[model samples]
Target chain A: MEILLSLFNGILIALEPINLGLAVIGVVVGLFVGAMPGLGSVNGVAILLPFTFVIQSFTGGATSPMIFLAAIYYGAMYGGAISSITLGIPGASTAVATTFDGRPLAMKGMAHVALVAAALASFIGGTVSNVLFTAFAPLLASVALSFGNPEIFALMLLAFATFVGLGGDDIPKTLFSICFGLVLATVGFDIISGEPRLIFFDITGFSHGIRFLVLAIGVYGIGEMIWTINTSRYGSSMSKVDVSWASMIDAMKRFQEAWRGTLIGSLLGFFVGILPAAGATPGSLMSYGVTKMLSKNPKEYGKGAIDGVAAPEAANNSASTGAMLPMMTLGIPGSPTTAVLLAGMVIWGLQPGPLLFTNQPDFVWPLIGSFYVSNLVAVLVNLAFIPVFLWMLRMPFTILAPLIFVLSLVGTYAAYMDMFDVWLMVFVGVGAFFLRILDYPVAPAVLAIVLGPIAEPKLRQSLLLSDGDFSIFFTRPIAGPITVIAIILILLPLFKVIYDKIKGKPAEA
Target chain B: MRRAEIVTAVLLGFFSVYLMWKSGEPPAWDPDVPRFANIGMIDGEGPGSGFWPFWLSAIMLVSCVWIGINWYRKKSPPSVSEEPFLDSYGKRTLFFVGMGLLGFLILIHIIGFYGGILVFMIYYMRFLGRHGWGITSLVSVSLVVFSFFFFDIAMRIVLPKGYLEPLFIPLYDMFL
Candidate 1:
């Protein structure tokens, strides 16, 4: 009853004219950005994050900007399907599974049907997962309220361990990348004491620490620009994207055909999304595989099966919503996009944890409210503006690239009115470009930077409480199990290599 | 790729060692106070300033050494390939675009935010991107004007004007 009342209040807040307008704007921008090849939600959100400062200044509160950013996140998931269905190009990595059947359907000249089915599936998945999020986030936060410093430190350790274990095929590289980020995080003044840690002898900016926004824009925005330019392959044909009442009715009729896959996908996606380092890419891919295995026409799996298109599309959307659960409840992000959102929340001075739900119900409820509204807005806006978004693709990259570059520079500069940050952003961008070439995951690095500050303090506090006894992390009941899980995750990769060697299979590097 | 992997590992290993060394350094030293006390626990306090950083740096050093071993054993996946980091066309694009960004940084320091954007856009579009002059001028002029109205006029966030500071007085008087 309390949740319902709060949700009602949140809905009321979301209905405000400015909030609604921002939601619409967010969805539009998300769709346009997502439809662009190689520019996923991470890039979309990072590039637009600095603009939220402008919005916050206009609105005089963090709530509107939060709503706007969340809406963009939800909208990007919806938009990612457009290119996958039309051109067989996954606009975002999450959309990769959508191309398995989506392109086949387009080849059959049912492009409109495939597009509508994806949008509708995405809508259903998001709405259902959001309902679960609204109910479970508070419950989980209550459980998290009992967590002590040791337990919190254990949880952060588990997050890092999971990234190393499941982040990629290369464990050592992943560990190195995360440690590098943590090292970078240690660069400013020591939080415990007043002395600076890693400040280069005379550089003034190093004393203040590297801003999350600066690094994010540099890596995702500027680094992505360089990557896109380097791998330019812009000329491609797109399927006709005309949606009418007739096509809508056809899609709705086919919904029954793919309902089972959609259900499986939504449930599986939500579950996977709750786990650290398991993002929409894995969620969608897993759903596609499971749906294929269970299908009656398994041979048609990759040959334009509507269920193939429905399953992954549904899964990725639900997974996006599910990723928000841990972020809001425990302040641990489940995926990269949520990591960015977590950083945004921190930047707005809204700490995302149990205290947030209790102390700032206004902020929490409204954000949850926007999730429900934004998903619906995304579906409608996507359906309505298909042609418009496709037309946006016609805009030349030569024009777009320079514009994005300028936006990045201006945005980074706008954050602190500092030229030093702009230079820092460029330097990070260059480093990020190199990192990407080496196939080292950048998300873990970014997450490490965000979690490092929180983890360091917790570790210090726990040690203080336990008189520097490291066993405190293993003796406490909650911390014990969490630490064990973290250890197990860290060892999993080594165990796999051993198992592979025992089986006489070529061990994976 | 193998060479790149080795270089990165060695560089990270050095960085970790440097961090460990730096983490042990205290702000001050006195005969009355315990040496390297910051990295250890105090009698009443649980841990001191350098405790977390010192331990984390140690862990990082171990991880870096592990990476080095993997690289040496030719067991690292990244070390298995000899792929060029970037092809000729990609290298050209990176070089020109990077130079453009460098120019942007230098120009921002000299010409101010809006002025810098104007010149950067014109240079990037006209020279680097090879877009025609008309479109470049159009984009450059519109971006400067839009940023002026948006950040300066509407939001009241005054960006750096550099030498163009005097030119904005009348506009600010009208807007503000």
Candidate 2:
């Protein structure tokens, strides 16, 4: 009953004219960003984070700005399907699975059907996950109140371990990328002793720590722009999309056929998204795989299978909402986009975690309410604006690329009014472009940069509490199980190699 | 690709070593403080300044060596790519775009934020993108004006004005 009243109050807050308008703008902007190649929710959030400062100043509060940012995040999940269905290219990594059947449906001249199905599935998935979050986040935050420094440190280790273990094919490269970020985090000054560790070369701006905002914009924004320019074909044609009222109804009727896949995706995606470092891409892929395994007509799995489209679309959207649980409740971001959101929360003078729920019900509840509103808004806007989004693809890359570059520079500079940050952004962009070409994953590096500073303080605090005993992490019951999980994550690759060798199968990288 | 992997591995190995050595140099020995005490715990108060970096860099060095061994054994994934890293078109595009960005950064230092954006957009849109003069000028001017209203006039956040400092005063007076 209390939860219902809080939710009702949240809806009332979200219905204010300015808050509603910002949510609409956030959803629209998210759609445009997500439809563009090489731009995902992470870049969308990062690029728009500076604008939140402006919004906060206008509104004289953080509530509306937070709502706007979270709405962008929800809308981007729905928007990522645009290119996947129309052009056989995924606008974001979460839409990669959507391309399997989505592209085939387009080839069969049913692009509109696939697009509508995806939007609806995304809405259902996001709504369901938001409900789960509403029920579970407070409970989880209350439980997390007992976590001390040791447990928090152990949790961070578990997050990193998941990235190394399940992130990709190359464990060594991923580990190297993560260590590189940690090294960067150690720059400026040591918080514990106020001593400088790695800033001895005396560069112009070495004393100030490297901002995650600058690095994020550089790597994800400019680095991706460069990669897209290099790899994309200059002028490609897109499939024609046709949607009408009759076709919409027809598409709705088909939803019953794929309801099982949608349900499975929502369940799996929500669960996977709550785990540290597991994100939408993995959730979507796992759901797609499971759907295929359970399908009676497995032979028709990937060849324009509506279930295939429903499964990943639902899973990715649900996973995006599910990622918010840890970010809001535990101050642990499960994905890069959430990391950027966490940074925004910090900038707004709102510390996320248990205290946020207790002290700032006005801010927290309305943001949750905005998610429900934005998911519905996305479905409506996407359905109404499909042709407009398709026309957006016709814009030349030559124009789009330069605009993105300019925005990245301006956004980075706006963070602290520092020209030095602009220069740093370019340097990181150039370096990241090369690393990307070498097949190194950049998400782990970004996550490490955000989590590294937090982990260091907790680790030192735990050691101090234990009187410098190294065994303190393993001695505590909560942290001990988490540490064991981290150890297993580290050793899992080695075990895989040994298992493959013993089975006389060639070992995979 | 194989060659790139080899060079990267070697560079990382040396960089990690340098980091480990540098982490040990700070807070030099005193009679009251034991040698390397800063890298360990400080009288049961917790780990000191050098603790996290020193151990993390050691782990990095080990990972680098492991990468090097994989390279030597010809077992790395990058060892098998026969294609060139970038084709001619890709190389040309990257070079021009990279130079344009570098020029923009240098210009921002001298011309201020809005002024630098104006010049950079004109160059990027007109020269690199090959847009018409009208489109280029319109976009360049509109973006600067919009930024002025958004960041300066309404938000009251003062952007770096460089020589254009005087030009924004009237607008700020009218708005603020």
- For residue A240, model 2's alpha carbon misses the true position, in angstroms, by 9.0
Q: Give the Å shift of residue B28 in candidate 1.
A: 5.4
Off by over 4 Å in 1: A1-141, A165-167, A233-392, B28-36, B85-91, B154-156
Best by TM-score: 2
How does residue A286 of candidate 2 score in lDDT? Answer: 63
Q: Pick by DockQ: which candidate is best?
A: 2
Colliding residue pairs in candidate 2: none
Error of 2 at B150 (Å): 3.7
Residue A93 of candidate 2: its Cα lDDT?
A: 64
User: Tens-digit lDDT track for model 1 on B1-176?
Assistant: 78888787788778777877777666753445453567888777667776766777777778778777877888876777877767688778788889989987887778788888888888877887678889889989998998788567743457888888899999888888
Evaluate model 2 with DockQ and give the value.
0.47
